[model samples]
Target: MNRFMQALGLSGNSGRGKAELGRMAGASLQETAALYPFALLAAVYVLGTSPLGLLLLAGGFHYAGTLAGDRQSRAGGSRLLLPALTAAAMAAGILAFGLRPAGAAGAAALLAAAVRGLITGRKRLWTGVQIPLPLWGIALSVILYVYIAGSNPPALTPHRTELYVLCMTNLFVLLLRWNTDQVRSASPSYEVDGQTASRIAAVNRRLTWLTLIPIVLIGAWQGFGPLLLRLARWLISLLQSSSIPAEPPKQEESLAAAELRHMAKEEIGGTPLWLTILGYTLLALLSAVIAAGVAVLLYKLLSKWLPERLRLWVRGLLQRFRRLRAIRRAPGEQAEYLDEVERIEGVPPKRWRRRRPDGKRQYAGDDPRQAYRQLIARAMKRGFVFRTSRTPSENGTELETGGRYTDYSPEEVRQLIARYNEDRYGRR
Candidate 1:
């Protein structure tokens, strides 16, 4: 493997590329997904149509940006794909809005998301905690608004209200699942057999059904059928507005006034419009509060019922998967993967043997096989020109003569290079 890579590494680099290494492929799809919900919430603050299209466009662009950034981290990453991707995103935004009847605000949001996602990918910005930065601000604003100003944001329209309810519901579920994942991580001391693991999984499955059943029932009861559903919907419509807009439309005013007069029997019962409006508003708010509380209570019960042994089973399964993948990969890919692992960890994963004094597994080694790789990564980071024509020994000599790696003596560096050459070619 070393012989093949070394031969390839010496193949001169102007147009010819060198062996790619040290790719950090950061940010999982979930963590990246977590960012966009907040961006959607930010758009929700303006409140006309739901920014569903904007949300979808931004998410695709963000994922592409991260993928492109990951590729560009390797050798030949920046060749042509990045500029093309940026141009594609911009063109997509233009066509989506210009050809379609999409709003101007939504189009502007799409372009902003594309640029932001690209910068995030190229710079590989660390999202603070596991979520994005904007979530923190949005959360803080909500907290301040509720506690200090003393009211919820004014009047979400019917569609906006429905989406807000569902999205918030899903967010709580994701948050609970996230917490379960942390608790599910296997601790070193605990262990479980196959039967016990299966039983633990059964408990989790039951708990999931336990939570989901009530939520389904609640949605069905409120939203199902025609007669009762229509009456429920009428009450919802009454809550659709409280204080009319200052410069109210004439047609809308007449319809609302007619509806209120007929429903409350304003002439016969002599009820004021504001009093009827308050009653409808209170009914909707109370129903929403009760539903949210019940959902939360169900989640709590499910979370408490989870067992620790499930985490051990999960860990065993993951380790088995990793071992299987290692066995299946082609030889060259496997060698490069191991080398890349060593580059990131300072020691290859395959080399962990013996326990340190602290009882942790020790992986301390100074293998001279790493000399060439260390020198190349160091030179690249320090802005030296990359040339693959030089052998490992020649590269070390150049670095030394040019006053790089000054901490090591010339003779020590030379000796390390010698061992690398011997180990590299001795079999041949």
Candidate 2:
């Protein structure tokens, strides 16, 4: 019994088990926070639709694929192929089960062609292909459910509510993913000073709050209005019309009969084809513009009115809520790494160096020129190559113009060079 308990990680003195549990808990919380909007939508959907098992299965596959892709990306390997294969396989399986054999084969062929087209040419296209895999998987799962439900002759009419929820949730997830990717790409990969990291975190938090507003609005619409339902219906009708048979009606059919048939089709569907397409196009554009404006205005207002202390508190709360600290590397590791890098570059260590009364580090000879040389050496370690014959000002200018340091601003580089020149050759 004791051995079994130990194997199950329930035994006392199991530090490894405890650490693994902590990691799992932290990952779970982070994922929950990241997908909170989708979770709420899923809950609403499951409560109304009663397709919990299918939804869970689809979500599980999607999460697994996404995690695989992210792992590959971090390792600087091909990131999209595995996700694409997983998503496509899941979609094909769902379609095969829910559709006629001919229809399933046709859809699978179409999906294969689309995936190939997306991933064939450029590296940039791989990312575009990978991002939509989860949404496509979820959409296919929903389609399978709707098809199954409609298989019953008495229940031929599709469930509009489930479709609406899927559309809204998919849109929200897409937006959230896009915003996250943008923020992540904008962030510097190298370690930064505390002030820079804090500023970046603040910007990310603000963007996150802005992104949530639209999702909240979507949730409200789901609860109180039929906007999403109507939109879904219109979109479905437009697609159906576009795929209509090219052959014309029989000449024997009376004009009134043909007109009545067309009207009946439109009524049964949702809206006239042209009007539906136009309305949705305009609606999408307007929503995008409004969301952008709202985000900008909210950011401006908060920056102007919110106190720093309150802002810090809010940031801290958000970090704790998301379990970010649990996932972040230890501060000691980061400090040690930075110190080691500085030592390798022949720069004085901040910790062991003597400090003046003004809190500035005192150089060995009490000369700012030597301090400037150390700073130049540090810059060299950061990829700023210096020529032995070049003067300090020339070296600084070359470094500034080279655009090697992606994390530093142009003005910051200019200012640093100016200070170095002033200390080295100008009146002090």
TM-scores for all candidates: the values are 0.33, 0.28
lDDT tens digits, residue span 1-428, model 1: 44433333423443112212111112323333344444445455642344556556766666566555544543336557656765676577566555343444455565555555556656655221133343343344344323323344454232333343333444444444434333334422213453554355456646766766675566546432233446555664555434333344466567778688667754675435665566656656766776788665544534344466765665567677775676577385434222221254455555534435563212224665555555555556666565534566566787678665334567766766677667765631
Clashes of each: 0, 0
Which residue pairs clash within candidate 1?
A: none
lDDT per residue (tens digit) for residues 28-111 in model 2 = 222222332333343334222223333443334433333333334344446556567646754754553454453344334334
Alpha-carbon lDDT, every model = 0.49, 0.48
Q: Which stretches of candidate 2 lie over 4 Å from their true place?
A: 1-52, 65-158, 189-205, 222-428
- Cα error of candidate 2 at position 24, Å: 13
